[model samples]
Target: MAELAFCLPDLPDVRDFATAQAVQSGMSEEALADFLVAVNEVATNAVTHGHPTAKAVLRMWSVGRVLVVEIHDEGRWTPETPPGQTPPAPHATSGMGLWVARMVSSDIRFETGAAGTFITMSFKV
Candidate 1:
């Protein structure tokens, strides 16, 4: 098991640390890059639209044949299943971050309620 916790601010430091940690964990260069991108998208969304004073917590662990990454934010944002069958257009620049995360990771889930919002992703090892 490998775990790290940090109260990341809405700044560049958040992205840097996420990239470093993923790379240090022996994740493939490509996997690490994808993980960093996904984590940043979630963190940025929390900072931008979730709420003020939001803090982030990240945990990574291995289970059987899979590696799991979980990110939690102290904000009241709910995750909804986009009501569509088709993915966003390739030319679209926005509204595709979460879609990308789901595509790269084997599994991605979001939980939200009065407590907070949490995003979890898994990759096959």
Candidate 2:
């Protein structure tokens, strides 16, 4: 497993770290680009929206042919609408990250409680 501890300032670091792990996990060229985009978006959401103190952790690993990347924030939240269920309106200024994540990742799930929010995204390797 590969892991990174990050905050808002570390957003760019998150992408660099995750991209390296995804490549090692054997993600295809096209998929890897999309996967990195998804990873960045989710990581951004975790720190900026989920955590009051802006701390988050990201972990990546592989099981069989699937690559899994998970982001965990330090606060609890449940969205008013299921995240990524629909695209944001054109005039909307934000909330497009999760939607982009869902479009690219093979699957995604959310688990939130008093501990925090964990977003697990899977990609075809």
Give each model's whole-structure lDDT: 0.68, 0.88
lDDT of 1 at 56: 67
Q: What is the TM-score of each predicted model, taking all chains together? A: 0.73, 0.93
lDDT tens digits by residue: candidate 1, 19-122: 66556556787677777777777666655655566566777777776667787767765335542224789799777777778877888887888777777888
Error of model 1, residue 17, in angstroms:
2.9
Query: What are the RMSD figures for all models against the true structure?
Result: 3.1, 1.3
lDDT, model 1: 0.68
Give candidate 2 misplaced runs (Cα > 4 Å). none
Model 2 is weakest, by summed lDDT over 10 consecutive residues, at 46-55
